[model samples]
Target: MLDTAALKEFLQQQLPANLELLKSMVEINSFTTNKDGVSRLGKMTAEAFAPFGFNADFVPSLHPDYGDHLVMTRKGTGTKVIGLISHLDTVFPPEEEIKNNFQWRVAGDKIYGPGTEDIKGGTTMIHLVLTALQKFAPDVFEEITWVILLNSSEEVMSHDFGKLCIERLGADALAALVFEAGARTGNAFSLVTARKGRAVYRISVEGRAAHAGSHHERGANAIVQLSETIQKVAALTDYSKQLTFNVATVTGGTVINRVPHFATAEGELRTFEREIYNCGIEKLLALSGKGSVCSAEDGHPSEVKIEVTQESPPWPRNNGTDRLFSIFSEVSSELGLRVVREERGGISDGNFICHVMPVLDGLGPNGDNGHCSEQSADGSKEQEYIDVTSIIPKAALNTLAILRLAQSA
Candidate 1:
């Protein structure tokens, strides 16, 4: 049996040092576009984890504008490998942080700063859990290989980072745990078991341009055709399958007096099931070049083209995910930490690797108001923050659960 009380006490004693580390990270602006800032934060993280026998490998991003992805590994005596996932970037820009004056501020129990709850807290949680495990559960720590993946472009949705994770962790990894900020509601804690996938697409329509008054009957109106097609795409949304589409942007004519020759629309689709997402995609694609527009008998017909700009495949909850959740639940119950599983509509790094292995996310500390820099002195407005008091219990919970998982595997 593990000494849960002792682990908690040790975590409590180390909270100050952990906060200091978190403060240092929060002070550095690591916006997704800020490659230099992201790399600096990754270096700091590597130095922090070096004490645990982990070495860092900096993999360059496919995008030259982004920072390199960090893959840190610690070899153990056993064959089973466990993957830990988090992002090094936040949504807040340097100008935004400075404009809002949202530096590290500690209230009664809340710690407010950029990236405090979204993900940097999650990275700090990794260090805290490992510190406790190294001190109290050294045997378990030495029995399994630990691979940590820190993304530099998660906010922008990773295309190369996902492949890099699979290459480093391999498909045979025991499980992947994502630290994306857990939730504490009253007495129960929540961890995410599923996340919805997302895809963005642009539709372009081309036709013959003409003057509205003089040549209206001789032209094919592309904007009118696109408007009719947009309704078809929007109608594909099904609430039962948890699938939906949104036509986010539209641009076409230079003036109201002309029949536009070209028009374009952009939108996104989201769902938790791959089959449903694929079906929706197929239906959307089938609509290309199938709609009607006002055109003369001899006029050129309008042509429609659809292209996918970006996509992150869905991560649905399955048996493997449930089994992993059960392990964490058992360990939490043993340690008097009651936990529940949650299905989130948001996507994470878990979506990329869940198919390769079982994935359990939301393992970070409790916090609220993510991606916002607003705050009010009268407690009216909210800002990004982590509950300072929730850190020790969450660390203890993660430490024991990881030990149990490694032992059972």
Candidate 2:
């Protein structure tokens, strides 16, 4: 039997110290591309769990520009494992952080910072939960080994990190919990049960360059043709099927006078269902071919090429995920917290690990305005913030949830 009242009291007592740690973490900028900064934050995070008997190891990324992924493991008497996942990186670069003047700030119950809502707070929440379990529920803490994965390139969607997660904890893990920011509506908080998959594509066009004024008709305009194709591509978005296409970046033409020889556009496709995802991919790939630009009375010398740069599969809700949520919700009700299951559109590490083991996400603090940084006088343009009050209760909930999961297994 567990003492819920005493556990809640312990979490409430540690609120101030946990908030201070979160502030310290927010002060350090851990942009995905900043290897040094990300590594520094990883070092600090690893030290926090060291006192609880976790041994930390840094795995180098596939590319040298990104920070090494941090994996911390605490051994237990049993071989069954429970994995907790979070990221150390934020979307904001050093320049954006400086320009937007986005640092940690406290006002009433909200703490605004760069990575506060997206994930840094989630990592801090992990520390708080494990600390509570170690002190209050010692038997539960020792029942299963804990595997903590804090990848450094989650903001940019690193495929290697997904593989690393499976290689480490996929074999015998009981359940994987992702600590992305949670959502609170009225009295109930939301836990993510499913997430949409995403694919990135780049389209390149080749044409002939010619003088604008002297030989306009003799030239092949790649930019114009690409723009026309982009319209067709953007029209692929179908709200009915929950499929969306975004033409993110476009680049074409060297000068204003000449008909440019090259053009390119980058876009993304996202969907909840696998059938829709595959269908969208097929249509996007089929668009690669010749363009409607001609070369001086000859045949059209323009060509288009489409490439899928990266992809992450969707994690649809299933029996396994529902069972995990049922277990978690029972614990929440016992602790006086109401939780609801949600299907989020954003991608996370759960999308990769769900197939390896049953996964549950949104186990972190509640907040809004995840990637926004600008601020306005009317309080419309809001920066990212974490609900200061939700931290302790969520930590207590997660602590009890983990305990019940281990004991039930």
Candidate 3:
């Protein structure tokens, strides 16, 4: 049994301290592409955790072009290990208008700022929890080893850095807790039991160009062929199996008066099941045909080409194994909160970890409008958000308690 009350009080005192750190981090604009900014934030995080006896290091990812990731650990007396994962990157491009606009204002108990709620808030919560454990529950900390993983490129599908983090840390991890922004107020913390797989693709069509009025029968229309291909791709979606295909963009027409010689469409497919994904891909690739001819160009014929890229694998729920879920639910209930378990259609770093261990995500402070201009500008709806500065310490204490239990077992 963990001392929930003592942990709560310790967190209440440390919230202010964590808030100050979060404010500084928010001001630093650590967008995934901003290498300097990301490195600075990583160093700052490492420095903050040093006093708590954590062996913290800023690990530059193996990806040559991505920003730095932070890996921090506190070794316990026992060998059973637990890992906490979060991303330092927010979903904002460098050229965006709101870049570096890190103004935080409190309106009726809610804090608003770039990266405040989406993830910086969650990171702050992790910090407070770990710090509190070091101060108030040294015995518990000494009994179990814990690792904190903060990646730099989670916003852009986490690319190479995410894979490196998982491959390195997933081998021995008992379970992973992903501190993505969580839900507000209700005991409803999503366990992230499952996630959909993603596949991005670029499709191009080639055809002969000709003047619409002069050589109407001499050119093949790439646009027409591409449109037919798009429909075929969309038709592959199987709603019953949660498979979906979307053609997000199309480009390549020189002028309206001329028959299109080339066109390209970019999109993605998402599915919860591997078979569904494979089936959809096969169908998408099999689509063929030069639909119609705007002109009769004897020398050139229309052609369609597609390139497929796998974004992330599916994270399936272990319906049979519920040790982590059960412990987390019980702990949240004891803390006077409702624990909600749900599946998300989207993907996260959890997908990578799920390949190796049972991962529970959506544990950070809750917010909406992720990856949008409004969310990026104001940090989601402040009023409806939970202050991790208060909630996370309790969650962390509960996690420590769970670690203690695992060690004893």
Candidate 4:
């Protein structure tokens, strides 16, 4: 039912062109905040898909800095609707240093560039794969409904655009394929079927201020209370349950001479289980509700509040997820590509789609150092890159996987 040989040959023939397309994508600094660059990339993407009869429209971003979401739809009479999700935004901002911003380059067997492996490669391959399928395998392409959501704000989290896009399209989706960099290879599961959810909180404390030199005893030190609270809050992280809590920022008090009246601590919570995540939240809220000893005889006061800033649910490895991975693995093995499974703590839009359908993530080309900007002092080398050799191999694998999925439907 699938033509693995023809698909491999098509991918091989299109490798050069796809690489150039990825180069252009990496060169365009579509940072989450660069509205202009993001919109420009969206236009370019729309133009690319237009030749294939995809009707593209820009969905206004809930926030201005994140640009807009690109939704492309193609008519098909298939049994189920298939969703392809990827993001165009990179973590590197536009005003950042040239070395840190978007700059495409070829070094040895790898492509050294920002967003190269993180997802530009994935997005490029999806375009190429779909394009090829539409041309060489028209029957397979016409057998299923296709919805493509190219998000522009994944790096800084959804900022509501991804949510709205999913709410709009996910209701009809039976399955989704996320084009993120796979974590590892040469293993049995090689696919990302599960990821941890993330929850962010801002814990604040308030206390009476007083002059440090004259009335230290009269002053209620909010900073000191917050400092002790940070430890108590961080202590809740349970590694056995794979729950983590980290205090990322703490701020209070302007001048050292005065006792601080207000202080705040920001932290993140991650977990692979929703129940565990909720348990941690309850503990954090309870901890934040009670303050440390200050000036009162009651010792700890009740001037604390914990607010959930944002959250993303964990995507568990379930039967449906395993089925998707199995299909992809069979196709990949047939194509002679490495296979491995990754269970990561990082969450993605795939986590959201799991609510409606089984989803697969990190199907991008094999590479490492994603979202890492670590560099030498002289800025000559980069910490991020995508293996040039794996580009078409993985893309070909995805092509076959899609064919298999369509056949099943």
Per-residue lDDT over 336-404 for candidate 2, one digit per residue giving the tens place of the 0 to 100 score:
789998999999998887777889999999999999888888988989999988887788788888887
| Candidate 1 runs further than 4 Å off | 296-299, 376-380
lDDT of 4 by residue, 151-183 (tens): 888887774755765665666566788889865
| Better candidate by TM-score, 2 or 3 | 2
Point out where model 2 deviates above 4 Å: none
Best by TM-score: 1
Model 2 gets an lDDT of: 0.89
Candidate 4, superposed: residue stretches over 4 Å from native: 97-102, 168-172, 184-189, 296-302, 377-381
Tell me the whole-model lDDT of each prediction, alpha carbons only. 0.90, 0.89, 0.71, 0.79
Please write out the lDDT profile of model 1 over residues 1-409, one tens digit for every residue.
Answer: 8777888889999899999999999999999999999999999999999989999999999999999999999998989999999999999999988888898998899999999998999999999998888898788788889999999999988778888888888888888899999999865789899999888999999977889999888788989999988999999999999999999999997788888988999999999999998988888888887447757857478998888888899999898899888998988888777899899988898898888888999999999999999877997877899998778878888898888888887
TM-score of each: 0.97, 0.95, 0.88, 0.93
Q: In model 3, which regions exceed 4 Å deviation?
A: 93-102, 288-300, 319-321, 372-401
In candidate 1, list every pair of residues with a backbone clash. Answer: none
Pairs that clash in candidate 4:
78-143, 189-340, 189-341, 190-340, 190-341
CA displacement after TM-score superposition, residue 358 of candidate 3 (Å): 1.5
Model 3, 81-198: lDDT tens digits are 7787888887655555254333565655566666776688778777766676667667767776778889888877765655666665656667677778765445455556677888
lDDT of 1: 0.90
* TM-score, cand. 4 vs. native: 0.93
